[model samples]
Target: MVPGLPLKNTQASTGDTFEAAVLAGLSRRPRAIPAKFLYDAQGSALFDAICELPEYYLTRTEITILRDRAPEIAALAGPGRQLIEFGSGSSVKTRLLLDSLEAVAAYVPIDISGEHLEATSRRLRADYPALAIVPVCADYTDLPMLPWLPGSSGAAKLGFFPGSTIGNLDPDEALAFLRNARRLLGPGGALVLGADLKKDPGMLHAAYNDSAGVTAAFSLNLLARMNRELGASFDLEGFAHEAFYNPAAGRIEIYIRSLRPQSVRIAGQRFFFDAGERVHTEYSYKYDLADMDALAVPAGFVRTQTWTDPGRLFSVNYFVAT
Candidate 1:
């Protein structure tokens, strides 16, 4: 039952992804799983909850920037363009852009979580019935060449990567993604990106380690997911979530630390953890304006403009592919 057109999932690639995660990747010196794996249906829902917590300022700050400057952002994106969003979770902020981009031809959202992506796309369809909603379930980092979408050919392509997701990638991977985006969007394309600014370490720590425990649940969901999907034996109670800022690295790192000496078996392979041992889950690198602008130049993009909230906690940058 192949899902046609508007709802498509790259099954082969996703299967390979699972194989890698279960067979070899899980049994590493310091076990780590790519953050993409953390967004299965349940994980995605938990993250949505995390965004609503009072401690999480990143989501609201970026939304404010978009709400206030949408027209200006839309103008730079140009009219009659296709809006292709990478890692378009929930698409909560996407509505602002969609409402402002009067001549937008179509909306293409790419996400790794197939079920969650489809659900979000369905909701968007109901709200924006007149618009074409193309949802693709695929990795944004290594995107397959985009097909020529209807009503999208002649119009400029506008790449929307909000959520400061670029921060999740290290500098090298982020540059590579931007460069690949350069090729995907072609010379006439523009990218609207959100980046979290470097701020007080306390604020950074609080954002990831929210008081409501949603962030912790999101981290633990990864383990629960492994137990369900990979046939792993992980005691959800045996590990604790920890997130903190690494000033030297300019990133916030999240880990699941073992509470005591423990062993878990995934796909029939055993891995042991000493007390206090941790498996790295995610890294979110904060960026200042200058550092972020420099990242674009090497990737063949020109940082034409930026919009930020009054608090300056976040930035939405407009980059033109050259």
Candidate 2:
């Protein structure tokens, strides 16, 4: 559970904003949707279920690494740091780091879902009373400045972007985000990030297409949200979940393909879908340690250390601002 009271909510888009974004994404030639939009309350809950699925090794593998190596990660990161975590859903994994860090001044957890963040933050505050908990309800990607921390001055800035979420952004967008984090952390600050490593295609495919169908429900929730918020006329049953590893791209491509010919409307605009036409939803890009290091250099960070599990399914990397 999240501890502490809610921080001043950071500004985010309104319901109408969802309408415009849907219009734009659907207007594209290939019809792609940003992964960010799939985190509405229902979608977020389904994702939590997806994490627990047996085939999804990401959460379990990464947790084992943090459970064992967090103390080492914190020692190199040093003390009296203000921890800022991006995409901190549920914040369950954050407990490992919070426990290991010596003297964290405050914890600022940023997420896209305002309602979800509030509940998580409330419970977290109960657990760690001495720690300042500032939950910002905003998309961390576009955030220009962080909210005020009650006693945040004089602490080293420690940025945490875990969950291999950096893979969600396109390479250019990821670079921009890296640069932004460098600026946010400033000199002498450091960042710890989790990345999914390139593995056998079979493992990757199974992780996305679990037997219990939670992932399918999670993918389909996007349509449920669109219909609710944007007045979209999408028949959720008409679509089927499709996720597969793309060797050429070194990523897992997830799409919701139309099972039959259909038409849908959102905010008065209509879109026609042919049988088997796909609405591309997400891409989980896999990376090697060297590829990550190459990205860090141009973003003003120097790769410090990286730890991988025995099975080598995932990695936790630490980088310092140069």
Candidate 3:
């Protein structure tokens, strides 16, 4: 578990438990909030907008790779497979796989935002009327178990984790997540993983710090969420979104920085911020093929194939669980 963040208590509702986390995170030095808190309904919508930005090459590049490779991916997945997607946002890229896969037994899309998941599932149901579409609304990292899908018995679990969301987690957390996924996927399972490749710092900077400020809104929305759910008095305008590439770390670090000295109240508790103090919100780590293997191999996944665009900006890898 990340410092100051408590383990998910299965008994408590997500909203009920968020207050404690918000308070604990704010109380710590070099304050940081879990990135998952940034995915409330509004935040999720803002992120969808981010994907459409011209500066954001990740979405389009990965989509192109998935579009081009879906057939080949399907061939490896074989028939009667149950597709399980982690962090299935709008599931825009999933359509390609659904269309190409032969006789897919079921499709399970797990997401943190319930409203967004429901909306996406409805749209998918309409389009794939014959397919069994199960939408799980929970954090994929702490998901307890998947609902049993009827008629999916003996179907291979083909896990799809796209958009390089794995970058959001620290190395240890990423490894833990992959290990959990391997267990959830069970024997004869596989994962179609997308990862953003290490590249020019200029390009990386532009991707996260878009001129349109959609990414800014997406990052700041975390504060807005605290205000709404935890009765926190956060001045949204008082803080600015900061994102830059950390070359030494080989990742993009994002923070919500305090513009001036201020005090904020959350759940009747007060906290002060110094001028220019930053509260870390997210980290998007870039990876090379070797880095990916080093991370995934220890988690019990063997890389079978990898595909990248001509620019080599992003990678889509096919890994089978051992």
Query: What tens digits encode model 1's per-residue C-alpha lDDT throughout 1-322?
Result: 0122477675576746865774565577777888888999999999998888899999989998999999998777767888889999999999999999977788889999999999998898888877877888889998867766764577778999999999999999999999999898886999999999999999999999888788999999988988888788999999999999999999999999899999888776788889999888889999998988789999999999988888889999999988
- Clash pairs detected, candidate 3: none
lDDT of 3 by residue, 92-122 (tens): 9999999999988888898888888888888
How much does candidate 2 score in TM-score?
Answer: 0.97
Q: Which stretches of candidate 1 lie over 4 Å from their true place?
A: 1-5, 13-16
Q: After superposition, how far is residue 99 of candidate 1 from its true place, in Å?
A: 0.3
TM-score against truth, every candidate: 0.96, 0.97, 0.96
CA lDDT, every prediction?
0.87, 0.88, 0.90
**Candidate 3: worst 10 consecutive residues by lDDT?**
1-10
Kindly list the per-residue Cα lDDT of model 2 for residues 1-322, writing each as its tens digit.
1235466566645465667778998998799888888998888889999889999999999999999999999899888898999889999989999999988888989988888888888888888988889888777888888876666666788999988999988788888999998998887889999999999999999999999999999999999999888888999999999999989988899999999999999888999999999989999999998889878999999988999999889999999999
lDDT of 2: 0.88
Taking every candidate in turn, the Cα RMSD to the unseen true structure, in Å, is 2.4, 1.9, 5.3
Clashes in model 1: which pairs? none
Query: What clash pairs does model 2 have?
Result: 2-120, 2-123, 2-124, 3-123, 3-124, 3-125, 4-125
Q: How many collisions per candidate?
A: 0, 7, 0
